[model samples]
Target: MTTLPDSFLSLPIAHRGYHDAGSGIIENTRAAFRAAIEAGYGIELDVQLSADGHAMVFHDYEMSRLTGETGPIRTRNRDALTRIILKNTDETIPALPEILSLIAGRVPLLIEAKDQDGAMGPDIGPLEQSVADALKDYAGPVAVMSFNPHSVIRLAALAPNVPRGLVTCHFPAEHWQLLNEKTRTRLRAIPDYMRAGASFISHRHDDLANPRISELRAAGASIICWTVRSFEAEIEARKLADNITFEGYRAAVGTG
Candidate 1:
């Protein structure tokens, strides 16, 4: 089994770069990422492949959620996407290289590869390939993870030295309903973390009590939990996870 770097377990990750729309610091924007770096927190962000095959740092397959534009993120090429403003802020969507340069290795970065099955089939390989290509020469504390096991496996093949993780949740949301039983079961069960060469696991904060997690923890696997919004939630997650990816409430972070 691959052991994750100490920084991966020690740092308090800023979910979406400590985003706060109320302050005009939109999630996945340059301003938000700078805030995390200035505050000395690791960053967790999502990336999707643009139409021209560049890795763009943004969340959701569609641009509407975080931007005024309403369309799939892939429809726009990198240059076009980089020029568009995000939400109501002055910040524009950033490319992966821009973010990597902005940080300049000031803190750790966790890149989540956003992908899913599409009309053409599993639409994750190209996304993984693009992300891998972007990070080829990035000399920083970094890791890649995905809710899709295939992406994780691909990263393992394409960039073996970079840490890989499996992001999972047991919640039965409506999205899971759309997946076939086999695919849904694989996602919920998360049986390929070890097989996929993942060095760590990032699970939903509320779903950390599964037996598999406990067994992995017992066997010395690194575990982290995500989107912890409250001090109370962080405390609960800390009992099972080695670290936290959090937002909303900032607490005194300990390296424990």
Candidate 2:
């Protein structure tokens, strides 16, 4: 297995590129990624496949939250997505390759392959394939992770040289009802990560107290927490996980 660079564990990861939409550095935009690079912090970003099979650096499955547009992100091609401004800001949606080129290995990146589309079993989804293709030629300190174990498994098979991780936690109340009992049980325990041969765990910050996470950490697996927003949460994360993926506060320098 390819080991992740030490910087990925030591430096705090800027969730969505140290973004501040109020300041026009919208999440996943080039400006946000540039800010993260300037701050000398690692970055954690999301990726989804576009209609034209291009990989895009975006978060929501829909464009409504970030952009005023009302449609699935994959409905628009890369050019059309680029034309849509993010939240009335000057920043437009960026492609994965564009952001990767902008970073140029300056800082490690944790790319979350969003798997909203049910990507169960062995078949690789288009998003996963697109992500693999985009990263194929890039020589950067990067890792791929996903809430869906299948995505991680697919990437592990496709890009064995790159580290892969499983993002796991108990589902929120709103999403809990959508999952069947078996799936919920599996996610709650995160047993699929082991089955998928994941090298790291990007767990929900609060859920690090679980015994499974401690076991993984004991076995020398990398453990990272997400969405760390406050100093208190950072303190807790420092205690349980190796690094943090943070946003909404001073995550770039660990002041928050």
Instruction: Give the winner by TM-score.
Output: 1
- Per-residue lDDT of 1-256 in model 2, one digit per residue for the tens? 4566777888889998988877878888888889888888899999987898888999988889998899899899999988888886877888888888899888899999887555334444787888888889898799999988888888888888888898888776566566677777767787776666777888899888989889988887888888799878899888989889988887546432
Provide TM-scores for the models: 0.94, 0.93
Distance from true location, Cα of 11 in model 2, Å: 0.6
Candidate 1 per-residue C-alpha lDDT over 1-256 given as tens digits, one digit per residue, 9 for 90 to 100:
3557787777799998978878888888888889888777889999988998888998888888877898998999999999988768888888898898988778889999876554212556777888888788898898999887877888899988888898888747465655666676667777887788877888889989998888877866789898899888988999989999998867445643
What does candidate 2 score on TM? 0.93
Superposed by TM-score, candidate 2 places the C-alpha of residue 153 at a distance from the truth, in angstroms, of: 0.6
Clashing pairs in 2: none
Per-residue error for 82 in candidate 1, Å, reads 0.6
Q: What is candidate 1's local distance difference test score? A: 0.82
